[model samples]
Target chain A: MVKKLRNYIGGSWVDSTATNFTPVVNPATCELLAECPDSPRADVDKAVKAAQEAYEEWRRTPVLSRAQYMYRFKNLLEERFEDLVEVVVKENGKTRDEARGEVRRGIESVDYAVSVPTVMRGYKVEDISSGIDETAERQPMGVFAAITPFNFPMMVPLWFLPTAITCGNTYIVKPSPQTPLSMELVYELLDELDLPEGVVNLVLGGKEASLAVMEHPGIVGVSFVGSTPVAKIVYETCAKHGKRVQAQGGAKNYIAVMPDANMEASVANIMGSAYGCAGQRCLAGSVVVAVGDAYEPLKNELVKRASGLRVGYGLSETTQMGTVISASAKERIESMIQMGVEEGAQPLLDGRGVKVEGFENGTFVGPTILDGVTPEMKVAREEIFGPVLSIMHVPDFDTAVEVINKSRYGNAASLFTSTGKYAREFKYRVNAGNIGINVGVAAATASFPFGGQKESFFGDLHGQGPDAIEFFTDRKILIERWL
Target chain B: MPSLNTFGAILTYAIEMESRLRDYYQAAGSEERARETDKRRSNLERVRRENVTEIKLEPIEGLDEADYALNLDDASAAGQQAAESTAARFYTDTAPKINVREVQRALERCAKQHAENASK
Candidate 1:
């Protein structure tokens, strides 16, 4: 049976009232996975109302109790870890192992939020004026909404929900219309957790739902993760509504290979970072600035490794990379590759027109490596968000850093070096939020703040860890004295 | 089979472990180092207090203190992290055997929290 996916609002599985629906496709086989509701503004209203109605009771529930619900949710997630991973693989088209990593990251967010008792703890100070006592407390900021992108339907919602809900704020999630089935399962599990009705709600759609979420008066805050253009829209709209927002934008993350770096390790890490998840992540190392003596050898090794990747269906054990999200995504990535070729960048290997066995209709884009890529090339500047690596050569570490710092995106930057001095200098000087000394994808763990700098991230506080607590709640101070 | 212990015994052991961690972080916090390290030590102290509060909720009962030993191998930041990790795993192992559902979950939550903090 084709699953009739619908919104989960006000403690019930509610169908979208709109007549039109979007077809959810399995990118691996170009198969129709499910029918996601093309949710309208009214659908957003219902979800937001549910969340706003549930906020008072949810916020009044003891923090420990809120954490207990998260524990239950986490247990459910672990018990069905493989099943959810399959959902991601089928719906989002990432390799099984990659899907597993994404699910683990989602689960890890729940695990971290289960520490809300500590994460949300406040402060006390006494004897300011011979008996004056002062205390500060953190309280939930009411209903919040998250607009998750298609590439990471499971992981991105988790990046917001677990933290927001555990901090005693109710949430409304608008999962990407193209990939809503996975979140359907997430809400199904949440249904069994006995949380207060409307504490967690789901609205499935694209722009309309997202815009409604941003403009809704009940939504005190908004969290979003997607491409830079939409992120800016959400940020601006939320700001106009006088709501708190954290919008994580796009990236052209760079990986610098220093002369002193180990060639073998750098090649391996770069291949994984650039090709893993079909290079559809904001933290993917799309550009490699190979400095001085490292350029030739590094390019050769990178090409060799990029050519060796096994591309097939995500469920296949031998498949190292999977399909992009949709047919349009495939076209977009391929067009970027062609643009690189036209711009005079040497095509080390072109992934365009690649076909996979058994899944002839699958949206596949094989690994592409472009050499002699200049910073002025559109492929080098924009986020291709695919299995494409652009290699640029520079004379020294300073030149490489200079080239990287010139880019508008500051999501992540990495340095591969054996010299501690050079590594430390690069880390300190890199104009990115997440930095890596010898790491490729310098993604922050659940326990640390994960965000970008400048255009990459808007707002002061980032998501995850202590920053999540700050984002979900507001701090209030009190002064009292007794006669 | 490993020796069985009461809820009080485990709680006491966890409290002792947190005390050792607190001492280690406090010493590290006082040392002249990078400002980031100072922030880390302060965060560790907060985690220590949180662990103590959760464990304190369990009822006291008869379980020998001799089986538990509080020791800190090192008083550095790395050492404190190791202690927190050990404590996290201890709670994870103890949770299933904990007869009360609420207490079991509390312990599990602490375990996951410390494990998270250890990585950070």
Candidate 2:
């Protein structure tokens, strides 16, 4: 019997008032792992009240003392790193290496938070006027909330929670119902901190609970990561309520391949970019624009190499590609591939027919490459969020950039080329927020902001690095002097 | 015999070996060798983390875990000697099969570490 998970409120695990519960299933094994409550509006209110009460004291704690908790937590996380990796694999269906990378990156966020005392320093300057001075200090707001996505359940929340708390803001997290177990484990670690109750809280639920948090007036800011349409809703809702918002949305990234690009290195990078994390990442390269004569051989090598990818359950060391999040995701990805085929694109390597030996019930999608894809096709324009790669041909480097910039999403764009002229030009004029030259996964580190432009992101500040500090705190200015 | 079908599987086997051998040396009298084993494990973990940044999807065909598997139940000096030789052979055998340049270099260094231990 799978136990239903609870909401951690006021430093205790309390059962939600919700009558509805969503099943948290392992995407690789199709096992019902746990039941996540569909928390009610009242439950969200209860969490807000707890966070608000804690914020009164946490905001007053010395900034250096607040950062001490972050460093200790980072050490605790390292000591138990592999255990968290196991939970991530069982809950999120990432392979051991992928789970390790996710957990490590999440820990890196805590590492970034450790610099709160330094980065959160106030700026003061002596004025030109006699005996006068001006000062600006970054101070924490009240309660903040994060509504994270299912694809990166653990990493995304860490990107917000640690940074927010280290800046002395109390936090409430509504982790996706599909993958709440990882955060539950994290909250268990946070519980050992011996801090005051309600400094950091967890609420597990579906849409109702998320909506409640978004609508709550007590929350000073709401950090969200999900689809574009829903991101717009979060942006509008937070704006209407006059709360600070950072809503990261969906993406359709393109990687242009010049004929002079290193075939061996480019193929390796392209494979990792298009298929890593089973192509669920926002920075995933979904479209390949091969310039002129680079199309045929690149297509052949991509098909041959991608066809050889070992697909199975994540725990298997031999398995390279894991499953999509759930059965519905697998179905949606297959239907998207079929739609591409119906629209005149050829299915060069179909993943729908691929299967693992023991995981017959798993939601697996192998490396899918769609050839002869056009710019206007649904597969080329839309975010499939699966292990599907669409290949298209362009006339030259200029045409490739035009095709890439025309997309509605501007999350990330990469160019595979040896020519400095094209690389420099592509980086300068690309519409995306992150540009990659001779690289595929152009993700920024925890010390840098990771968000998008255009329709891909809806706010000013992003989720990681200095942007997080800037997002959670506001600068107060002082202009006075006593002679 | 553990099946070593890919580079990930091979690294997993190596990690398991490091832990067992480190435990064996710590329980017996060789504290210095145990520390070396622990350091090697940490290095291999670093490799594991780096390799995942871009997983090499190519299947490794020829390596066998049976060629390097050790019987650590014995608690004598000969057992330690055999374990060191096995570790050396595991790295020497697996280095050529590695596709990634960093992994190959790390494996070479590991082989040298164990070879020095076996000689002493």
Candidate 3:
């Protein structure tokens, strides 16, 4: 049976205003899985209106009450976690394990949002001046919008919306058109918590829908995650419109393999960072900068590990890697691979034309590796957003740091080394927003703020952690005099 | 006669404007999602204004309406295709080209940076 696609507006599922329908395709089989309503301008308006109306009461809800709702939402997410993972894997084309990880990360955000009552508490000072007292409090920012990307459809939205709603702000989410179902399911889960109608809404559209959100006066703030180009646009437009904005963009994350680093551990970490989810993640380590003479060894190890990866449908229990999101991604990654080859980087492992058994119709790109990549190459500079890892050799630690710092993106970078001093120095010197030593993936926990720097992120509010609550809320200082 | 610097500046400005236009559309859509009631009218207005502005700002001369519309449509379709293709390829193939855990760790680093910034 085909699943019906609906927009969640004011806590209710409604059909699209337009007759047009977008078929949800399984990337693995190139088969139609379901259909989604092509959310028209009218549908977007209805959802937005519902959220605005709900905001009147939702914004007034007691912090403690909001906290209660968040707790319920968290429980609901956990309850539906397995189903959610399935949907994510099927629709998003991520491996089942990766889908589960995304869902778990999303649930963690909701769990953190549930603690808003404690996190949102204000600070009070007895006296600043004679007979004067001051107190500071956090307040909801009316209505807020979240523009999430296709990657981590569930987790990225939760990274912002949960905190926004829990902090007493109504939320409107424009999930990526590529993976709208996963987010729509999340909306349904949120609805079961019985939060006020219109407090949370989901609109599925493309640029037209996103522009509407940025231009609308009712939206007090906007949070977004996507490529750098789009993030820049979101940031500039919202800022120009006087709305608080946080838009994360692209990344060309680097993993610097130091001389003393354990070859096996580093290879394993690099394999996961570069190939997991086929490198669709915003924080994927696209560039591997090897310090000293470790480049050749690390490259060999990475290739060996890459070759051993079991690629299949995300639902396959034995599969370690899954297909890329769609057919076009395969083309792009292939093109980038071609570009890398043309740019003089030696192809260690060519993933192009890789065919999976039984899933021949699936959109699959093999894990690819390029060696002797220079900093000037497009493969090294641009965000490939694929499972193609480029290895650039650097003579010394300073050179590695320089190359990393020189990139336009500053999302994340890592160093695999045993020396504490070298690790500390690399962490301090790297221009990346996130840094790690011996660890490949450096994503922050729920308690830590998450964002990037330079072209990688375009706004003030980073998603999750303590900053998330603050992003969803505004600060108000109160002054009083008692004679 | 535009100098090299002037031409470069103009190119940069055009790129920036194109980015801003895309963002504005996204933000407007986000607004519609949040507000819901005035979605169609606002979206139409925003799209219309952006189209007009984009056309007016076009550096090429004598581009007709049909051509412009076709170009815009092509661009949009291309973007959608790109997104879908990228997603599809990543999900199907199993020759592990990149590592998932490492990517997560890298994302975590960004999260940590934000946390540190907040404390300050």
Query: Largest lDDT belongs to which candidate?
Result: 2
Give DockQ for candidates 1 onward, in order: 0.02, 0.37, 0.01
* Index of the highest-DockQ prediction: 2
Q: What is the TM-score of each candidate against the true structure?
A: 0.80, 0.94, 0.79
lDDT of 3 by residue, A142-204 (tens): 888888888888889888888888888888988887788898888888878888889989887
| Candidate 3 Cα deviation (angstroms), residue A295 | 1.9
User: What's the CA RMSD for each of the models?
Assistant: 15.2, 2.7, 20.6
Winner on lDDT between 1 and 3 is 1
Q: Which residue pairs does candidate 1 place in steric collision?
A: none
Off by over 4 Å in 3: A1-4, B1-120
Residue ranges of candidate 2 with Cα displaced over 4 Å: B1-8, B23-35, B42-86, B92-106
Local error of candidate 3 at residue A461 (angstroms): 2.3
lDDT of 2 by residue, A293-361 (tens): 999989998998888787888888777778899888889999999999999999899999677888888
